[model samples]
Target chain A: MILQYLKLLKDKRIVLASSSPRRKEILEKLGWNLMIIPSEFEENLQWESFSHPGDYVVATARGKANEVTKRLEKCGEKPYLVIASDTCVSLETQVFGKPKDRHDAQRMLSLLSGKTHDVISGVSAMLSYDDGWHEIVFYEKTKVHFGRLAPEEISSYIDTGEPMDKAGGYGIQALGGTLIEGIEGDYYNVMGFPLHKFCSTMAPYFGRLVK
Target chain B: MILQYLKLLKDKRIVLASSSPRRKEILEKLGWNLMIIPSEFEENLQWESFSHPGDYVVATARGKANEVTKRLEKCGEKPYLVIASDTCVSLETQVFGKPKDRHDAQRMLSLLSGKTHDVISGVSAMLSYDDGWHEIVFYEKTKVHFGRLAPEEISSYIDTGEPMDKAGGYGIQALGGTLIEGIEGDYYNVMGFPLHKFCSTMAPYFGRLVK
Candidate 1:
C-alpha cells in the first residue's frame, strides 16, 4: 500500500534518534538503510508542562529530533531526515515512563494488572528537505489491558528483568505479551512506531527526505 | 524464542485446518512447513449451548480438528498434528462472527465504534501419534477498543472488502488497524492465533517447544 514512497526513499540519508531496539527492528523491517544516532537530549521533562499526556510525548520526541538534526547540521552533512519517538503508558490519568528500578517496575505492573491502560507513542520526523527545516509530529495511542496477575506472578516477571528497561515497566513485544489481556491500538505503537501513520505522513517526503 | 520444537517436528506431518490467510502467514513466519486442509464442518451450532463464549470457540475449533482428523485418518495419512482455531468478536455479551453482508458489516462496525470489545480465539491442537489421539483446547481473549469511527470511514473501509471475511468485521492485521484506539492481550490472538500459548501447549509433544 505504501509502495509509492519506495522510489523517493531510494537515495536519501536517514537517521534514527533513539536507543530503542524495538524501534530499530521495526524500521529495519521496512527495509530502510539508516544510521542509528542516539539522541543525547535528557528525557526528564516535567509531565505537568503539557496539558495532556500526548503533548508531553510529542515534546520529548521533538527534543530528540531537533537534537539530532542540529548535530548532523554541524557535521557539514547536507541534511538528513531524523526520526524520533517517545512512548509512555498511562492508566486512567497517571502516566508511566521507564521504571527507575525493580521496585518501580513492580509498582507499575501492579497498577496495570486487571486494568486497561493506554500506550501512547509520539513520533517526530524532521528534515532539511524542501529548502527549509520541516517537521511532522503525530501520536498513536493503544489501549492495553493486563490480565489479573497474582503478586507472585508479577514478582517473578520482574525478576526476568524484561520490564526494567521498557516504558511502563513492560515490553509488549516480548515476554510482556503474556501479561497483556488485549490491546486496542496499533501493536507497533506499543513497540514504539506507528508504521501505518509513519508511512502515511512520510509519503509526501519519501523521495526527498527518505531517499 | 521457540526453537526447541524443530527436531521433533522434523519428520512429522503437521496439518493446519483453517482457511485464514493471516494464520497461514504467521505460521510461515514461525518456520513451520504445514499442509493446509480447510475444514468443511458446519459452524451452525447454537452459541447458547456453551456457558461462556470461550467454550463456544473451543467447541468450534475442536469440531474443525475432528472433521479434518477423521478425513485424514480415512485417507491413510494420519497427520502428526492437526491445528484448528475459531475466533469471534464479543462486545458486552453479544458475540459477532463474519458479517453476512455489507449491512451486517456496518451494523457490527457501528456497534464496535467507541467501545471496547473482546476477541476470543479458541485453539485446538490434535496429535495422532503412535500412542493414540491426544488433543488440547484453549482460548485466548483480547480486549480491543475502537476510536469513534465516522460513517464515511466505516463505509470506505467496508468498500475495501477486508471486513467481509474477518470475524467482528475488522482485521487487526490490515487496514482495520487504523480504526483501533487500543488493545490489551495477545496481538496475534486478535489476528486469529494465540502464538505464545500455541507454542507452550505444543511443547510437550515436540519435546520442548521453545528454545
Candidate 2:
C-alpha cells in the first residue's frame, strides 16, 4: 500500500527529518528508499505560544522539516519532500514529552495510573514548490488507559529502563502494553506515526510529482 | 523480571499445548524451556453452551488443557504444569472465532468497523498434585475499536490473507494495528495470551512444585 505511493515519487528525492527509529521503521515498511536527515532544529519552543497542542506539535514538525529542507536547498539540490513528525502524551490538560529522569518518568507513570490519556502526533510534509515551499500539517490522537499499577510493578518496570526515552514514561510496544487497560485512538500514533493518514494523505501527490 | 519467576519453575516439567509460533515466542522471551504439545481436540464447541462469552472460553481452554494432560498421564509423562488458552472476538452481542473463509473474515471485519468490541481470552493453568489435579481459570477482556474502514480498504486488507487465522479477522500485532482506533485491555490478551495473569497465578505453584 505504501509502496504504491512511493512509486509515484520515483525520480524525486525524499528526505525524512526525524531521528526516531520507530518512524524510520514504518517508512521503510512502506518501501520508501529515502535519506535519513536528522533535524538539527531544537524543540525548545514554548508550549504556551500555540493555542492548541496540535498546533504546537505541527509547528514543531514544520520547524524540523524546514531545517532539513533549508540544508538541502543550500547544497544546490532541488527541493524534495521533507517529512517530520512530533508526538506528545496528554492527560486532560497536561502535556508530556520525553522524561528527563527516573523521577520524571515515575511522575508521568503515576499520573497515568488507572486512567486514560491521549497520544497526539503531528505530522508535517513539506515540498519546494515553484516559488518557495508548500507544506501540509495534520495531527492524529490515540487514547490510552493504564490499568492500576502497584508501586512495586511500576518501580520494577522503571528499572527495565524502557520508560526513560518514551513520552508518558511508557513504551506501549513493550512492557508498557502490560500497564495499559484500554485505548481509543490510533495505536500507531502511540508508536510515533499515523500510518493510515500518512498513506491516504500522500496518495493524491503520488503521480503528480514523479511525472 | 520474567526470568526471575521462571527460576522458581526450574525443577518441574512444563507443557504448553499450542502450535502458535507467536505464543511460543512470547514464552521463550520469559525463558521457559517448555515442551510444545499441540492438541488435536476439535474446536467445535457451541458458543451458546455457556451463558457468557467468558465462561464459554474458559470451558474451551479447560478442555484443551485436560486433553493434553490426559495424554501426558497415559504416556507416563506427568508434567507438573500444563497451560492452555482460548481467545475470541465479541462485537456487541455477536461472537466471532477464526474466519472460515474470505467472506466470513469480511463479515467479521465489517461488523467490527468503526465500533468498539471486546477481545476476550480465557486462560487455564493445571498442575498435577498428590491427590489429583488443581486448575485455575480466568478471563481477560480488552476492548478494541476499529477506525471507519472503506469497503475497498477492507477488501484490500482481506486480500492480504492476514485475517483468516486470527480470531477477530484482525491481528493487532501486524497490519491489523492500522485498522484499530485503539484497544482497552491486556494487549497480550488480544494477541492470544494474558501474560500478567499467567505469571501471577502460577507464582504460588512455582514455590510448591520446584521446592
Candidate 3:
C-alpha cells in the first residue's frame, strides 16, 4: 500500500538521521534501502519552554535532520529525504528520556504503574526539492494504560536490563507489551516511530517532491 | 508483568490448538512452554446462524479447543490448558476469511480499500483444574481503516503472497501496515491474538487453575 506511492523514491539515496533500531526497523518495512547517518546534534534543549511534549521532540528531531542534511551536502551526497525522530514519555509537564540506571528506570515505571501516560514521538521528514527543501514535522501521541505492577515485578523487569536503554524504562514491544493494559493509538509510535501517521503524511507529497 | 502471574503454569503442559505462526509468536511472548497441537475440527459450523462475527469465531474456537483437549487426553498428554482461536474480517454483515486465490485476494482488498472494517478474533482458554475444566471464551474487535488502494497496489501486494493465509487478505504487521490509516482497539487483536485482553483475562484465574 505504501510502496506504490513511494515508487518514485525507491532508487533514490535516502538517509535516516538517527540510529534507533526500532525506527530503522519501521522504515525498513517501507522497503527503503536506508543509509543510516547518526546525528551529532546534542539533545540539551530546555524542554520546559515548549508548549507541549510534541514540540520538544520535533525540535530535537529537526536538529538531527538539519545537521544530517548539512553533513550530506558537505560530502556532495544530496539525498531525497532525511528522516529524523525523537521520542519521550511524558506525564503532564514531565518528560522522561532513556533511564540513566536501574533506579531511574524503577522511578519511571513506578510513576507509570496503574496509570495512563503519553508517549510522544516527533518526526521530521526533510525532502529536498528543486526550489528548496520542504520540511514536514509532525508528532504522534499514544496513550498507554499500565496495569498495576508489584514492586517485585518492576524489580524483576529491571533486572532483565531491558529498561536501561529505553525511554521511560520499558520496551513496550517486548516484555513491556505485557505491562500494558491497552493502548489508544498507534503501537509503532510507542516503539519510537509513528508509522501510520508518517505514511499518510508523506505519501501525498511524494509527487511534488520527486519532480 | 504477565510472566509473574504465569510462573505457576510455566512448567505445565500447555497446548495451542492452532498452527498459525502469528498466533504462536504472540503467545510465546508470555514465556510459556507451548505444544502445538493442530485441531482436526473441520470448521463446519453453521456460521450464518450466529448473531455476530464474535459469536461465530467463539464457536469455532471452542470446537477446536474441545477437540484438541479430547485428542491430547486420548494420547496421554493430559494438557493443563488448551488455547484455541478463530479470526475473521467483517464489514456490516459480510465476513471474510483467507483468500482462495490471487483474484480473491484482489477482490477482498478492493472491498476493504478506503473503508473501515472490524477484525474480530475469538479466543478460548481452557484450563484443567481438580474437579473439571474451566473454559473461558471471549472475542476482541478492532476497527481497522485502510487507505484508498489502487488496482496496481492490490496486484503488487498480491504478488508478495502475504494475503493468501491472512484474514481480510492483508497482514497488518507487514506490508498491510502501510494500508492501514489508523486503528481503534487492541492491535494484536487484528494480528489474530488479543494479547492484552488474554493476559488480563487469564491472570486472575491462574492461582485456581494451578492448584
For lDDT, the strongest prediction is 3
State how far residue B210 of model 2 sits from its true place (Å): 12
True contacts kept of 3: 0.56
Off by over 4 Å in 2: A1-15, A26-35, A74-81, A127-133, A197-211, B1-15, B25-35, B74-81, B127-132, B195-211
Candidate 3 chain B, which ten residues in sequence have the lowest lDDT sum? B1-10
lDDT digits (tens) for residues B1-211 of candidate 2: 2324445566668899888776676566455688999976677888877789998888889989999999988988888889888999888778999999999998988888889999888888888888888998998888886777778778878876789889989887676766765665566778888765676566566646435
Scoring each candidate complex against the real one, what DockQ results?
0.21, 0.31, 0.55
**Which prediction has more favorable lDDT, 1 or 2?**
1
**CA deviation > 4 Å runs, candidate 1:** A1-60, A63-120, A125-186, A195-211, B1-3, B208-211
Query: C-alpha displacement of B30 in model 3, angstroms?
Result: 1.9
Candidate 2 structure quality by residue, lDDT tens digits, A124-145: 9987677877888899887886
Model 3 lDDT tens row, B108-189: 9999999989999999999987777789999998888788988988887888778999998999878788778777777788
Off by over 4 Å in 3: A6-8, A130-133, A208-211, B6-8, B130-132, B208-211
Total clashing pairs in model 2: 4
Give one clash count per candidate, in the order shown. Answer: 20, 4, 0
Q: Give the whole-model CA lDDT for all candidates, comma-separated.
A: 0.80, 0.78, 0.86
Per-residue lDDT tens digits of candidate 1, residues A119-144?
A: 88999998675586889999888778
C-alpha lDDT of candidate 3 relative to the true structure: 0.86
**Candidate structures ordered by DockQ, highest first:** 3, 2, 1
Specify the poorest-scoring 10-residue window by lDDT in model 2 chain B: B1-10
For model 2, report DockQ: 0.31
B48-138, model 1: which lDDT tens digit per residue?
7778999999999999999999998888878778999999998887899999999999999999988999999999999775777899999
